[model samples]
Target: MAKTYHHPKHDIHEDAGSMRADTKSRTTKFTSRHMAVYQAAAAFAKPPSRAWRLVWSAVLSIVTIASATVAFADALAVPEYVGSARCADCHKDAYETWNKSHHALAWTAPTAGHVLGDFNQSSFTHKGVTTRFFREGEEFIIETDGPDRELTKYPVAGVAGVAPLQQYLLETEPGRLQSFDVVWDVEERRWYHLYPEQELRGGDAFHWTGPYKNWNGRCAECHATGFEKNYSPVNRTYASSQAEIGVGCESCHGPGEAHIAWADPALSYDAEDWRGLSSVGLTMDFGKNTEADIQQCATCHARREPFLDGNPLPGAPFHDSYRLSTLRPGMYHADGQILEEVYVYGSFLQSKMYAEGVGCINCHEAHSADLKADGNGVCTQCHSSAGNPEFPSLRLAEYDSPAHHFHPAGSSGAQCKSCHMIERTYMGIDGRRDHSFRVPRPDLSVSLRTPNACSDCHSDRSPAWAADAVAQWYPDGRHTQFHFAQVLSPARLNPDNARDDLVDLAIYDGLPGIVRASAIDLLSEIGDPEIAERTSALLTDPDPLVRAAAVRLQRGAQGSVAIQNLLPLLDDPSQSVRIAAAREFLNIRAVRLPSSVSQKLDRARNEWQQSLVAKSDFPEAHIVIAGIALATRQFEAAVAAFEEVVTLDPQHIDAWTMIARIHAALGNRETAIRVLDDAIKANPQDISLSLLRTDMLP
Candidate 1:
């Protein structure tokens, strides 16, 4: 009998979050003279004589130069979306599906119909602290103990979601920024004070008005469309805005204007493939394409940083810009069960399915967020009973019954995922199941003391008993060794003695790239003279990742030999290796180099600067460059970079504080005072800013 596949059905009729009705009230005021100059420059750029072109170019350059001089200057104005009404005209099916999915209703407007929680004067206590949730006319209000036991009334700006915990948003800086308070009770269905013990001790991180209150920098990037945090560190304020309130049609499709023009039937989008286009509508063959695009989505969704923002340039690889979480300590347990806060993407990469080219879209439908097919149906798509002709040894029949599972047919224990994939809850209620999909190995579990599927089910039973049961079921079965399990023990126990073993593991070709990279990281901690020499030779390794690791581990080594070996890797094909080389070289400031090598290093630095120019709105990039400039004693460059950072992201209090220090160092006391005044206006309730101002006054 053929096994039937079961697809999980997901409701796709949910509403996308709330609309920002208050956006029209806030307007950015630019200087009249600057606007006039910009208009004149725009007019001069039109088709004209050679003399006129020269005049236009010069004027535009002047305008560009002047615009950077002024603080809080708005360049690109984001267009507002009317609503989902426009999208429904062309894509009715997709719109309907999105409405049903959780993406639509992730955040919602407060109303009698839409509001889920009990907001009518309710007090809830958690961890020995009390918080009251009440209503101020139509708006929801939360009253919690502020600094010195003072009761503070915070208005709920918006609701996060319906199920789980209904998180409330607080407007810390009115229109400019809003932040989510950390505490919410799922069982009592009420709001509670977060970090109650710390609050009682008078040292709470989430005291009403803190650095975390700048929601635009902390949260808006992931939630809204084209979000620019627009924080001014010098001013200590946020002037953040987005193109859209929630994820809209343009989020995935790129800008819709070009797409709309192409879709018109009158004008052929492509002259060559008109008939082919009519026959087959827009369909992307995800299976045929390389994993680059899929990896781009994974970059943000999987807990990685932005190397470049908006649209990444072609051939710019993922790992070059972002540092992925390795299977390191605190992230995973001894036998690879997730222990700390992992965002799934790292763990998923470890699976055999991912290595076999199975992507996120294979299991998950794009629009609906539902499983493409149910249960065994998804697994059998590639693994058929007829047998995989590519790998004939994968006979499906041997693994299809109670004999293999050692459990009765139709039982919960018989299900494949039940024994293999374990579910872990995060953020109190969000249950995420592991996707690594490894079979239960109780024998290894006993040796390593990692949790096994049998012990997970039979909580009272020991690993020894589980191993004996597995042996009884398959008497001749061999316990396969995990490479990580093998290397981890010696690496942790005797770091000094394990140098050679770690280096060998780092260069091992057959081992997984993640494991190899991890071994390299471990070796960096206790690497001696011999290991450093071995790592120096690896600067010429074919793989960029290994070569990059080699550069990182050999940072502190002196002498001309080490510096000469690393200079050539500055132009490596992989940006990761080049950046690594740059950082390593920058560390050894006094090391003399050949003029040509110095020139190559300068060229690499310019490339990094150019990359930053392309994504000027990214605050993190500015901060990194500013740190680099400060270290090099380029005080002017450092000040400029930090100023740009503050303008791009106002909620950066640390940046503002640093800018004031820089001004004071430069003997510009007036400028420092003005910067503080701006910061105080942005966050008037910030006690730290108040204290800083008092200290600076004298």
Candidate 2:
């Protein structure tokens, strides 16, 4: 799969748990956790002899999640996670197809064939720092700047990814793996830096050795199957484990224990009819269900904030556990084409293909996870003169022909993906295609400064030239139609002035949920007085994104009005929407509601809290927890949570400041001053901290 790691920033998704694959979730707010982790760990040790070996060849250990769960739901017994190797016994063909694919090799212990990078005293220098990659017996050793800014040798504990680039995993301490940022370009066979332009040092969030790079918090959920990030926030330690160290059959096909027993009756011959089990003993039938299958792939493929931590099983509802990021500024072009590493889900959500029920497996093979065919062949599977019978909504057309592309046959321009799903190189050599699959809109590009596929090939030409060429090719096209970018681009810059325009866009029919949701998000930022009344219609919008965004717009309303507006949504079918509505009611105290509505609110509130706690490793979650505690008059609990934030992230200035203020509010002047002093000591380089301490001193 195409991958990229964007520079970490202060990303606080209203409700998200883990980063998934996109380091976009590994935010600057997590900078302090590096200090905390480094302080806790001792001297680095050489990696053991091939300890990180991939586990799919055999099951290592069994974790019966349904051990206690079976009693309550006997008929629907959740299966034990039998590893991928077990599935091979019966499904030989499927196992063989996947055994050598990228998914199978997504993560592994650095064995002979697994370690691709040259470890024979290779040195790579970036930002005036020379890092050496060398072999220490059977271990891959990297000599680089440690958290204390001294050159230290750390052994590679594991390897992540297998393709354009591979990142080394270092166990900074027991049970804590940090994803070293110095990546190996697999294709080029060279080492490169992710942040080539800047000099990153100790405590920097984007630094290779920072908490943002911690494997337990970030990568394990996507790279491993049945992964559990057993993070202990109190002691600041981890006991992370996974069923398999790579994306296995169980990762996508769901736990195969029941499937295995169903296939081989001897395994559970004396038990109840296993065939009668839901999905014929499999967790889900990905081969048959389009939506569930796509969602299963999206578990690792999408760039979104997670709602719950730990890897949810395959076929779990995507919305129930994730809050998909919209086409937010800086991450996406104004017209909703990919700009950053959003992976696939957000982009796919914008495509008409997704609306038409086109799923991951439609063009890509199920086992290998690669395209069924190359380039135009993939698109031609449906776009040919004879349309695919599976999708009757598609019009019969010869899209692969040169006449349609206006380019000579066999040229890059003539390829179907060349014009629609253009590629953007990220994480050095990793080139990711925009899954949104939008048409070239150089006309919008000319007006909005967004990238267009025409510009991608014709690098020297102006947008106007490309627009004219497109106009000549198809005069009656969407190229000239009014696009949402016309309003959204300017709204991003000046939401205040674009209030009316945003309200209009949010209410507009036939737009993608993200576009409308983004409009509502911008409107909320503008503090539009009439926001609650203006976007009222969107509460019932078919898209959960719209409903959730609409629920957020009711944040500031109080009394019976707030309850009336957000109370109904507490029971929303979408877990994401219910969580959104639950948060809106968190600070609304002393408001009486219908008995049913009150019950829903209580349930939704718990749901929201559990989702936040699921990502307890993230400091942002603690900040949210503190806010909740403060709202409910649990000042001591709020302070304790804020202190937990400091423990995880000592560089979090706002958290330290909040801690001081809370103490001051309780009339503990001496304690407040002491807290400020501690904050100053923790962050001596920050002038703002010095000033805060000075202001607090009598």
Candidate 3:
């Protein structure tokens, strides 16, 4: 007879931190339930501290464990930051390197020496509006349009960034720091507007004073140390604070107080003897030998949603603190090249290097965040003709030689990054490189309309020329197995014939969760009953991201089936999964749901609502709230929510579209036409709005 262990029942509740707290507690209890499995795999534990947790989980779950466990290091309570100045005393070499690095200068006070912008009454004109940069009694000032569209003089509060461009922060209200639209290009020694073509006026969301540009809510956390966006949703204000103005030593290494405590000459620093100290006297272990190293840097480098409502610890599990963005249409090109301002993480996750255990520090110095070597020197470190015995997968022969590159030695085309990592310009002047570390495939650029490194520099040549060059060099076809974009692009463009392929891709465990999630999300457009039915199995995918994406795909299924598919996910271990389930489940009418099922749905709905409220400071969050209200038939609430999105960002086209649709649904056809006309007036070039207006005309 087999024994069954019933998981402890958890009473779900409505609270800001209730769900996560409950999950942590429940998972802790789950460890005890696997006592038998724990003893069996005790010897397999590698790192004595972290191994016990994973061995028990892997043995009981009967799944191949991914080295490290997701278990939060419980040895430490909340870390307390000790300022960077305190660290300089013992670690002089690291301190000096960091002091001269980009991270240290990422943010700074507006001192004359620190201010790289020429504030000697310099002026820049954009769209007929002139912004004057001048100095006033030891203060840097910028005369620009205020929130009301009237010209106003505001004192520069701080400077952000250093080399290519430096953005100024202006205090529009007490404690409200808004990034100025006009920035100074240090290299060019000239003032320029970030949005040169668009006439973005005050009251618009993209305006400097708007939520998207607010330094406190949008950009401060990544730039500052121990920052907290103390947002009050009730009053719609921020009392943001930070331990330090710039990224400090503690920012990457976690809080230094515990480390300081253990570092004292009186205390024992031995790893074996420091069991009583918090996490062995370190808030985070940035051991480059461990998997957590890449994650530490990715905490801020990744384009992700901060699920936890505060600043995250340096080395915390990414899933606990952030919901990493997957390869979505607007965020990434169909061929998986970055299209928008998706920071490095999403692109790097798609790379063969990531799968081969390459991390940020492999090519970068941990302290300075600079490349270990210049140009091809970095590539030669691993791909040299001698070859790296450990990384046997590397095709390491004469990579830097002209014969391999088919370009003149020392030419721009011969550089490894020039061929593999294409540069995309963002913020008008800053050119960030794609870190996916992929082989150049100009063929995909032709078929999928995706940018390739080959085409980026070859302005006089075509992709066909580049593809032929690559074909001749390799002889065999470029590796397609690693190129997920080939299958994904077709699925997105023609889901009718590609539905079965997409379903297989979505549930395939061999691929990364991000790839699988992207496939599942694409299936959302397919209203085919067969695809919908087959996609139901993905609701229980081991990965939470896949499960969440599957919930969206099943939204078009029959009401009863959709509800059934989503019900179990309400109790998912991951809050993001539960939230996705709850929102999708509520899309169906509650009147049709069985009494018992409705009760569960209500619980899930409340949880979802609370999660949305937690991120209410964001315009996107309000849009999601509006969508929920519209789906649940709360017409007035939906209208109010949509209106709030416009209030937050006047140029939010989606809000205007939803508002018009609601009015039309409520039989106010004239009002719908008026709304569309207004949106079209604001954005004349928006073809979709123009088409919608023409369709709405009586």
Candidate 4:
């Protein structure tokens, strides 16, 4: 029999815990004792091995959640997780098919076959630093700058990724893995550093030995299955662990123990057993071919923040486990085009394809995770003249024909991806295609300063020149009339002037959630007292991302009113909303919460701290910690956190400025001047830093 995704025989719709209005009774039942148990378990479960402590904490959290959850389905009695090796017994075809694929080789122990880079004392130089790769006995070694800026020999601990680029993991300390800044370009067959233009010396955040490169904090969760990022804020240590070291069978399929039991021929099973728990012992229900299937792949593919204790299971709701980043500046262009290394999910969510039910599996294989076809073949599956009848809304067009594309056959200009999905090179070498799948609009590009596919290929032509060419082709202005970038661009630059435009964009439900959320975020810059009520009311928005943005916008409102409006969100079902509410509420110092409300505020505050602690290695996370400390007048703590930020990112002018201010606050004028001088040296090109230093002169 051909394999099929398992679904419950009956259609049963279940709301997420926080979204269900009826679950208020269940939430009310959760007492102080329950909260105490959670705290006690976290406190007392600290075994020497942080790995074991995480396991204990997870088990306790699950138990507490199970007892209190009324919005979730009945718990599936799944057994313990079994390794991927066991799946080969019955699924030989799948096991073998995936064996040699990139997903299977995504991570591997350093060996003769797995190691791609040359190790015959080959040396590569970039930004005034030369790293030598050579073999020492049975181990691969690289002689590079260590944490203290001295030449040191480090053995290759593990290898991450394959094909386009491969990065080697080096063990800087026991149980701490750091990715080498330099990567081996597999196709090019040369070592290239991510930051080739700028010198990333030791102690810099971008350096391989620094915190941003720490595998445990930054990369392990997605690379491994059943991974636990066991970070301790007190000791500033990591005791991370995983069930399997690569993206194994369980990584996408979830645990296999119960699936193994169901496969047994000797076992007496009923209809319910065949239906077999949550999507066949997996956490996600994929049979419906819904958005959840794409979300499973998105868990690793997107730039997002985890909303819970550990990595969420497969098939979980995207918002339930992770809070997706909106089309925020610095990450995306004003017109919602990919501008940074945002992966795919954030961009895909904005496309019409996703809205029309186009999923990852439609273009890619389920097991091997390879594209079903190469290049235009993947798109032509649904976009050909015949078209996919499944989606009748998509008008049939002979996309492969010369009449449609208007370029010579087999030319790069004629390719569908060239016009629809432009590629942006990130990490210096890897070219990631934008998944928004938008039509090339040089017209909008001219007005918004966004990149257009036409200009990408036509190097000599300007956006206006390309726009004129497009006008001759289309003749009609219909295609260029509708664009979110026009309003978004002005709103980003001056929200005060674009008040009506931003408000219109925020309330426009027809637009993508990310775009709407971004508009809401932009409204925070508006100082209009008239818009206060409008922004505050968005706290009740259905989308968690919108609510999150609304909480930030409400920060400028009257303190008592802001606290009252945000108090209810402290107990919101979504972790992102709760944390945002807590953070914003705490910022309003004038409004003191009553004891009844303070209890919930305290728990939410702890969640905010944990979120920052988990990402402690990041300079941005340290900045947040510093901001919180400074807000509460914890000068010493704030100074230390800001100093840590400066240590990680030497050229961080904002952190340097904060550090100088903290010293000045403590009545040390000389120390403040010294800090400014150091910042000026690190960021010589920064006129702001130079000006600030001149102001600090005695």
Best by TM-score: 2
lDDT tens digits by residue: candidate 4, 208-292? 8777677876777777777777665444566777778788888777767667666787864343532234644544556476576
Question: In what order do the candidates fall by TM-score, top score first?
Answer: 2, 4, 3, 1
Better of 1 and 4 by lDDT: 4
Off by over 4 Å in 1: 1-87, 107-114, 146-149, 175-203, 206-214, 266-290, 308-317, 383-395, 398-400, 474-478, 532-548, 556-577, 589-698
Candidate 3 clash pair list: none
RMSD of each: 12.1, 8.9, 12.1, 8.5
**lDDT of candidate 3 over 1-698, digit per residue (tens):** 00111100100111111114312322233233232223334444443333233312322221122221224334324446888998999999999999988899889999997899988988988887898989999999899988999999999899898978999999998888998888889989988888788887887777788877878877888888888776655456778888888899988777676687677887545544332234546646666344578777877787776654455666565654556677766678877788777788778877888888888888899889999999899888998888777688888688898888889999999999998888989888999899988788888877777788888888789988888888888877573434677788887667667777788888787877788888876777666666778778888877777787777777578877776777888777666787677656555555466766655555455445434444557766665555555444556556666666666766777778878888888989899998888888777777888888788788
- Decide which is better by lDDT, 3 or 4: 4
lDDT by residue for model 1 over 556-609, one digit each (tens)? 465465577777887786666665666565555466567767666754543343
Among the numbered candidates, top lDDT falls to 2
- Mind sharing the TM-score for model 2? 0.85
Give each model a TM-score: 0.68, 0.85, 0.81, 0.84
lDDT by residue for model 2 over 485-598, one digit each (tens)? 999999989988998889898988678788888888888664333777777778888888899888767654544666777776877877789888877665456656676666
Instruction: Estimate candidate 4's alpha-carbon lDDT, on a 0 to 1 scale.
Output: 0.71
lDDT score of residue 340 within candidate 2: 79
TM-score attained by model 3: 0.81
What overall lDDT goes with each candidate model? 0.55, 0.73, 0.70, 0.71
lDDT for 21 in candidate 1 is 8
